[model samples]
Target: MKFGARNQITATVGTVKTGDVMSQIDLQVDHPHGMSSVMTTESLQELGIKPGDKVRVIVKAIHVLVAKE
Candidate 1:
């Protein structure tokens, strides 16, 4: 699928936790870090996401905030 988001990362499914209405998907990304996405259970089902599956993580945002101590 094509998306407008510029930040897309290829990752492998690590874990999937599905609730009654929502699901939390954890991706095992490249080296040292990973990401998580929360979506509706229906959406998750539509994507057919499962453990060990390869998927793209798309991130689109207008503003990103950074904090320094």
Candidate 2:
């Protein structure tokens, strides 16, 4: 598949939390940090995401905010 986003990362599924309308996916990336994504339950079912499955995380955004204390 082709995407306009340039930021993509390969990660393994760490957890799957499903709600009535949405699902939260936790991923264990190669780096020390981890990533989380929230999508519709329908999309999650279509993708068949499960623990231990390897997936790509694509990030496309207009702005990223940073703050320092």
Model 1: runs farther than 4 Å from truth?
none
lDDT of each: 0.90, 0.90
Q: Estimate the TM-score of every prediction.
A: 0.85, 0.86
Residue 64 of model 1: what lDDT? Answer: 46
Q: Give the per-residue lDDT of model 2 (tens digit) for 20-48.
A: 99999999998889889999999999999
Question: How far is each candidate from the true structure, as Cα RMSD in Å?
Answer: 1.6, 1.5
Summarize candidate 1's per-residue lDDT along 10-45 as a digit string, tens digits.
999999999899999999999798889999999999
Q: Which stretches of model 2 miss by more than 4 angstroms?
A: 61-63
Model 2 C-alpha lDDT versus the unseen true structure: 0.90
| Residue 59 of model 2, lDDT score | 82
TM-score, cand. 1 vs. native: 0.85
Model 2, position 16, has a per-residue lDDT of 99
Least well predicted 10-residue stretch by lDDT in candidate 2: 58-67
lDDT of 2 at 48: 95
